[model samples]
Every structure is written in structure tokens, then in C-alpha cells.
Target: MTIEARFRIDRGSFTLDVSLSIPARGVTSLLGPSGCGKTTLLRAIAGLERCHDGLLKVGGVIWQDGRRFLAPHQRPLGYVFQEVSLFDHLTVVRNLEYGIKRVPKSEHRVSLNRAIELLGIGHLLERAPGTLSGGERQRVAIARAVAVSPRLLLMDEPLAALDPSRKQEILPYIRSLHQELEIPVIFVSHAPDEVARLANHLVLLEAGRVVATGDIQTMLTRLDMPLAHDSDAAAIIEAVVTGHDENYHLTHLDFSGGRMTVTGNAMRTGDRVRLQIAARDVSLTLERQSDTSILNIFPATVDAIIDEGSAQVTVRLLAGDVPLLSRITKKSAAELGLEPGKPVYAQAKSVALLT
Candidate 1:
């Protein structure tokens, strides 16, 4: 499935002109700073915002065209905003039933119980939104959205209203939804870490314009893009669960040319997962060593050496088929005689895992 969207919204003061196609299955994030029109674009896609020239398609169905715009009530969209917009007077179960009751019997693909189970909200079914915590209320809202079994799910910073602790509390449920649900998700957020954790595809917008949009790895390591300048600049990789060491309590994950021993999550043997290796955490070694404490050692061939003026240069490397990026000082590059195709090893203290 695929999503094709374009908008030419001309308000008196703000005009947004963007044309981009997004993937249909994974979580695609509409990322930007505040007032950059991410919310407007999401509203337009959901048929909540009206414009003079707008086009939208989801899984081959046209939600909007130049002359015809599908009514929001008629569209198959489940929307969750920053606020937990639940029926305060109703219990959580009743709120979920509110959405289920709107759809015909045949259209109800996701059951109320399933939504509750998927969101880990079974215990809160009897409680009112006012009685629940921020995370609980947001989970109820998300469960309510999923109960309808819409074709697409649109979330506008669904965790933004909560405090940091509360936000962390609800992220695992969101991650579970992404891993388990079949429906496509369009998430809008300004938080870089949130996007980094949740988004499979990213759209970077600035001043009402889309600057970059692609897979998360390509977007993150792109030095030309704003994300590479972030203090948390990193690279992502998908690895297979090879084995685990019972003695050291370390899980072995396999990637292209080498294996990594990460303090990983629960995964069965042979399961594929994605991991985040931060650029700042990695150090390069010209020769493959034996006395180092580092466990992951890949014979990576340098792909590109980009000098970012001053003291920094980014080295793009190919460890077998997998691509990795290492950020080092220009002085180090000159001292080590590093160049394209020069073999090296990258040592890291830790790697962050998402899936």
C-alpha cells in the first residue's frame, strides 16, 4: 500500500506548499518545529482541514481531490490528539463502545476487548477518564480510537500533554501497537527523541516546506539535514538474534559482517530487530585488535569521508552490506591516514535498541 498527498493551502498569512508520498504500512512521522504546519498537514490528510487545492489518497482510495473532499464522518480515520479527548462522563469501556457503536456490525474488525488488551487498559475499563492518570487516559483514548478499526490511525503528539515520566510510561504501549497493528499510522510530533523512537519513515518540515523525507536511517545520518547536527546523531541497523551467553548474561545480535553483544530485550532466536548506534559513542581503530574490551568488531570499509570544517569529519562506512556512520575529529582522520575504502573497526560502549 502507498499514500500520495499534496497540498497547496493559502491562508492570508501562512501558505503551505508541499507534495510528498508516504509509505502505507509503517509509522510515518510528520516532524517539524512548532507552527511549521505539521498539524495542518495532518488535519488536511484526515479531511479535517479544508483547502483550495488539496489531494490525498490512502491505500488506493481517494480521500480528497481538487473538487471533492470526503467528509470526516465518512472517512475511515481514527484520530488521537495531544489532549486525551475522551468522554469524561463515560467509563473507559463506554468510551470505547462509543466508537464501536458508530460503525456498522460488519465494519467492526477490532473488538472492544482486543483494543483494551492491545493497549493494556483492561483494568481501567471501569474507571472514568477523570479518575485515570495522564498515561492511563491517553491509553484509553488510543484504545477508543482502535476500537473503531479504522483504515488509518492519525496521532498528533498523543503523549505531548503528559509529563516526562508519564510520557515514558505510555511509550511501550505505543511501540507495541506499532509492532502488532496492521493499520497504517501517521504520527505528528516536534520531539526528536520521540520521532527517533517511533518513526519508521520521517518527513522533516521547516517554514511550511518539506526539506527531507525518507527512511529513518537515511534521514538521521544525512549531514546535510538538520538531524545530523543534533547532539544525539546516530545510525540504525536491523540485526538477527543469533545467540545468548548465559554466563555473562549478554544477548548476541548478528549484523552484516560482525556480531554485537547488546544488553538487549526479550527476543526469540532468529528474530530480527532494529538497533540505534550513536555516532558519538563509536571510536575507530585501524587494525583489528584482540586485547580490547569492546566486543563488536566489524571490518568496515570507508565509503565517504566528509569534512565538516573545523575539527569534525563524518566517516561513512560499509560493514559488509550494512552501512554505518562514525563521527571523528578532522585531526584524527589526518593522523590515522583515513580515506575511502580504508578498513577500520568501530568500538562502542553501548547501542540503543528500538524493536
Candidate 2:
């Protein structure tokens, strides 16, 4: 199933003209710079922003067309804005109940109890909105949205208002939403890290137009995209935990490329996790080196290279079928005689466990 959207909105000097089909599962992030109309496109999907020439269909159900348009209140979607927006007079439980009341009892797919459990907000149920911390308030807001059991969930920079620590506190719960629920999520954010950690499908927007759309793993590593040239550029690898070394306190994750040993045993065997390997953290070698402290090394074939500034170049490699990226100096590239299809070993100094 897919969500199809076509919209053309004009306001003075700015115009949003886009047409795209997004997969109706997992988290599909609308990623771009600020003022790129990420939020506008999201609003259009929710029927909050009416476009005369817009067309929207979710899972083959027509929500809008030339003659038919569903109003914002008629759409079965829950929207969580940047602000907590909880009523000061209401308790956390009450705020959730308010959202529940909006939906008919027969339409409730997510029970109130399940929403609370999914977000880990049971303890704060009785606390007033004003009494809760920023993270706690956002958790309640999300639970409230989930309690409605909407077919789709739309979040507009939901973590934008939170501080760094508070943002960290709520990310895990958001990740669990994807794991525990079947509802599709449309997440809007300009932050690459959040998109890398949360998005399964990526829709890159530029100046109110669709630049590219694909699975997160492919979109992030494409050498032709601006994502590869960014300083924080990284590759997303989906790996499953193969085993744990109890004595060494390390976990083994296996992907298409190879096994990676990380510094924690918290994840269980056979559990799937996402690993983020930054381009800057990877170094290339002509031969496998066993003496280095870096434990993650995979034999890869060079696919492409692009010069970054005048001194360094970004190398794209294929480790088995999985894509990996390395940022190296021009001199190093010349010394290694690197070119397309050249065999090399990629040494990853550090890897972040995103999930």
C-alpha cells in the first residue's frame, strides 16, 4: 500500500509543487532544510492545508480529489506538533482521554492501555500537564495521539522544542512506535541524525519540490546526493545481533557486508538493530591490517569517488552488497591508487547503534 500525494500551493514568492508516492509503512520522513515546505507537505497530507489542485490517497482510499475533499476533522489522522499543546487544566490521562473521545469507540484500534504502555507513560497518567517535564509532556502527547488509533500519525518536528537531553529521553519511545504499532508515520525534520535514526523511507525535498525518494539506506549513501557530501554523512546498515561475548561485553551484529562487534551486550541475540557508520570514521587500506585497534574491517570494492574541497575526497564502496563510505585525503587516494572496482579494506573507528 502507498500514500499518493500531489499538491501545488502558491503564496506570494514561494510555491510548493510536488507529486510523490510514499510507502504506507514504517516512518517516512520528509527531510530538507527549513522553509523547504516539509511541514506544508505534511499539512496537506493531513487535509489541514487545502489545495485546489491537490490529490491525496492513503492505502488506496481517496481522501481528496477534484470534487471530493475531506476536511481536517474528517481525516483519520493524529497530528503532534512541536509544542506539547496539552491543556494546562487537564491531567496526562485526561489529555489522552480527550483524544480518545474524538474517535468512535468502534474505530479504536489502539487501546488506551496499549498507548500508555507503548510510550512508557503509565506513571505520569495522573500528573497535570504543567507538573510534567518537557519530555514527559511530549510522551503524553504522543500517547494521546496513539490512543486515537488513527490510521496515520503525523509529527512536525515533535522534538524541536525540547533541549538536547530531553530530545534524547523521548527518541527511544518514538522508535518503539515504529516497532510496536502498525500505523504509518509521517515525520518532518531537518535534522539528519533524527532522520537517520527514525526514518525507514526518505523523501528529500528541495525548495518545495521532491529531489529524491527511496529507502533510507540507499538515499543516505548515494554519492550523487548532497547527503554524501555533508560533514556528518553516514551509512545506515541493518544488522541482526548474532551473539554476545559475556566476558568481553561486546555484541556481534551481522549484516550483508559482514559481522560488526560493538562495545555493549545490552541487545539480545537475534534482535535486529540499525548501525550508523559515519564517513569520517572510516579509513581505507590496501590490505587487511590485524594490528589496529579498530575491530570493524570489511573488504570492499570502490564504487565511486568525489572530491570534497581540494584536499580530500569521498569514496563510495560496496562491501558485499552493502554500501559504505569513506572520507580520505587526496594524497591518500593517490598513494593507494584507488579507483572504481579496486579492492580495499574499510576500517571503521566507531559505529553508533541507532536502534
- lDDT against the true structure, per candidate, is 0.84, 0.92
Q: Which candidate comes out best when scored by lDDT?
A: 2
Model 1 misplaced regions, further than 4 Å = 264-266
Alpha-carbon lDDT of model 2: 0.92
Mind giving the per-residue lDDT tens digits that candidate 1 earns over 1-355? Answer: 8899999887778878889999998899999999898998888888888875788989899888878788888889899988879998898888999988999999888888888998888888888789888888999999888889889999999989999988888877777776777878899999978887888899998878899899887887776887776667778887899998877777899987588888744777898777888777777988877898887777888878777658898877777777677888999989888988888887766788763
User: Candidate 1 at residue 305, lDDT?
Assistant: 78
TM per prediction: 0.95, 0.97
> Candidate 2's residue-wise lDDT over 35-76, tens digit each?
999999999988888897799999999999998999988989
| lDDT measured at residue 93 in model 1 versus the true structure, 0 to 100 | 86
- The clash count of every prediction, one per candidate, is 0, 0
Q: Which 10-residue span in candidate 2 carries the lowest summed lDDT?
A: 173-182
What's the distance in Å from true for residue 83, model 2? 1.2
Best of the candidates, TM-score: 2
